[model samples]
Target: MSNASPSVKTPLYAQIGQRIGQMIDAQVFRVGQRLPSLRDLASQNGVSVSTAVQAFHWLEERHLVEARPKAGYFVAPRSRRPALPAVSCPPRHSLALQRKSRTETIAVFQPQGQEVTFGAAYPVVSFGGACPKDPLFFDDDRVRVALARATRIHRHSLIEYSDSPGTQALREAVARRALHLGCQLLADDLIITSSCIHAVGLCLRAVTKPGDVVALESPTHFGFLDLLESLNLRVLEVPTHPKQGLSLPALQLALDTQPIKVVLSVPTLSNPLGAVMKHSDKRALVQMLASRQIPLIEDVVFNDLLAADERRKAAKAFDQDGGVMVCGSFSKTVAPGLRLGWVEAGRWKDSVSMLKRVQGGPTNVVLEQALADLLSQAGYEARMRRLGALMKDRLQEARGLINDSFPRGTRVSDPSAGYTLWVELPGQLDAMALFQRCVAEGITFGPGALFTATDRFRHCLRLSFAGAWTDVERRALARIGELARRQGDAP
Candidate 1:
């Protein structure tokens, strides 16, 4: 229905809805902004009130507008352009990664069923849409087919522990996939792991010992901090730009003053902040680290989501001397339940592969084969393109709601790709307190405090829109905004 051109074959009401969608897209009417009343629209377009109602129904179905109780239809928050978050300037020193208690870890997510799992404690808070767990996000039938085929093809492998370096077919598939990231990986060097985190863990073990200082962008994935803490490593968070990503100058300063061992970063479509370092910046970062003999654990997990294919190139693409350890997974972009990932460990290739062989065994041959089958699909790019478009829509609506309901000083990241959003609430708005409140109302998000070892992000939070897009999710976003406003209003 949304794809119908404004031609004669299109229904009149649909044509009206399409026009309104165009207006909303053009920002002639802001998201969360009201539209003409049914009567007003009917009169303006010389259509019946029923026709106007139909037009609004069409708009609502497309997420272009929403109706309020006892009020006429108003434009939905569908604008993806939110005010970008301010640059982050964390303390210039390194500190040991702190492993907070279960209580604190629980605050990172509320009760949810989509992409997250929690401990046996309190009720889960709803992420509205956390991970894309629902079948709506993937071709489940195709996934089942691939899995079945892989099992049939590799049934004999069940009798043995799979090859330590993963199946050659899957590794070759991974190498072929990495070409889009501009990395010509050798399938022989690629080691498939349980997941991306597993690959990163191997890299960390190969390079840094306990108490080693690793520099990364601020307000990063909490999972990284959890890994560092478990490994007994210290974290030096470089000041990061919300849009541009890690500050090279700040990182160079830290390296000059501190004993930084390794730099872990997501140069393209970084997590939480969704920042993408420029191509030149990526090269410069590689050169800068290579000169200092520091290994860069570059994560290209979300690099595929960047709107432009050229921008999707991983930082490892510029690694002249085997200095960048690149890791990635298909869970975010493909079937999450598959639980598979791969890595090219640069200079530490043998060490990482050996670590995987000893510490964590290779991924199941059936799963690897299934993933290989999925990757070999001719329509994979089209599937990702659709997912990318869906993410843009969700991000736009989320930003609109944040603009409409959150406190005035609130700022959110505006990324061209990716499903996660970083929201910086107004002054004195404690995100932890806000999380507690949101949990009560069945709405939850990752508080900024959990993202770092520092207390600097006390007023920020990260939200993901990878879950199913439903009215409940939409209302949850509005409720979160309302609850945040109340936090500031509290005495």
Candidate 2:
């Protein structure tokens, strides 16, 4: 057979696709709007008919455009567009009624960076997204030795399916570590998960049926609230304190009156508020939950970030009747991309482990083993110490900036641990509006409303100092404060 020549590549098709994508992004061709016919597009893009056809086919496959029989390609309708499930909320009067102009209703201040992402709870700084900076005394040698050991022992098996409960060594490490928290857990008590979020999901699936009522912190982690909504669970909001954590009395009232199956909360280092439950409150709450047989899901992702003395206490520490399902993750302390987290399922270990199997078969074995190896290193504890100091310093720097720059009436939270600062703005200043303005300026943050069932904290905002240079963060803080003042002054 004669050799065939390679087909010539077409640049025109790519250019046409780019143009169409740009138009879609800019909303020049809005959702549901009919796209130009192949003939028309070829004429407009100055390309051959085949080139335009190729481009349209490419776009259609990627879901940016949809082909309609006899109608040609139209911008995908809203229903057809790929989207995250709509987060549910109770109906409320629109904020539009308060402002004279619709434009005025939206915050105009732009954070010095990109999109209006303040609605999402993430740190504006690069480092704020995940683990904190390591301190001066971290021992890298120990980590290396541990990895070497894991490799020598596991070798080929590292790539194979891990036991449902995770590596025995890792489970034992976790159980031994739990002892510091006053939790007397055996290896059997732990069910390893990909992340704390996964752990929470498994616990939810294990305990409650779909449509069961779950009580959550009024302004809790939006991710959890969204998860509950997706699982078709009805959420009942329980009021929480900004500093002391969830309200015990309110939780007690809800427990007594409502048919709540689970209470999800962050007893230590809450996401937006940076609240830590008092020891007495933790005892009372645990007792209450145990007495009522209510499962308490404690998100302790930030647990290890606490100072040494603080490590001795945990919500699980006080669970006399195994009512607390403690979920902890190395993502916050180590690396998030590693996705190493575990659930100390007090009484629901088998149920959670089974759910883990159903959800994704099993987590990445090599990654989990790598993390286990890293933990085995003596350097892990030293690295944690260093991270703690750096975080403490960063927290102080961010707190000072907020206190100095924010408007006079603004109340900044005084968190004993964790890198988040919760600022309570004047009632008139909507954090969501402020978020939009900041996003336009190239900054992003976690808005207050997403954390709550009601818009009760519309005036509040959470800032993370986990990442970013001190100079950039200080400037961002000053700009944020100025924006708050402007919004507060606005009629």
lDDT of each prediction vs. the true structure?
0.83, 0.68
Error of 1 at 11 (Å): 15
lDDT of candidate 1 over 1-491, digit per residue (tens): 12211211346887788788889879899877879999999999999999999999978866678999888788786543447788998898899876684356764455455544332332344562345664555777777889998889889988986547888898999999999999899999999999998889899999999999999999888888889999999999998998999999999899899999999998888888999899999999999999999999998888877655697988999999999999999988778899998999999998998888877566788898999988887776766666676577668767877888898889999887887889999888998888866775556777888788888888998988876657677777887888899888989
Per-residue lDDT over 297-337 for candidate 2, one digit per residue giving the tens place of the 0 to 100 score: 98878777776745537888888777899998776665555
**Candidate 1 lDDT (Cα, 0 to 1):** 0.83
Q: In candidate 1, how many Å is residue 388 off? A: 0.5
What's model 1's lDDT at 105?
70
Candidate 2 backbone overlaps, count: 19
lDDT of 2: 0.68
Q: Candidate 1, which ten residues in sequence have the lowest lDDT sum?
A: 1-10
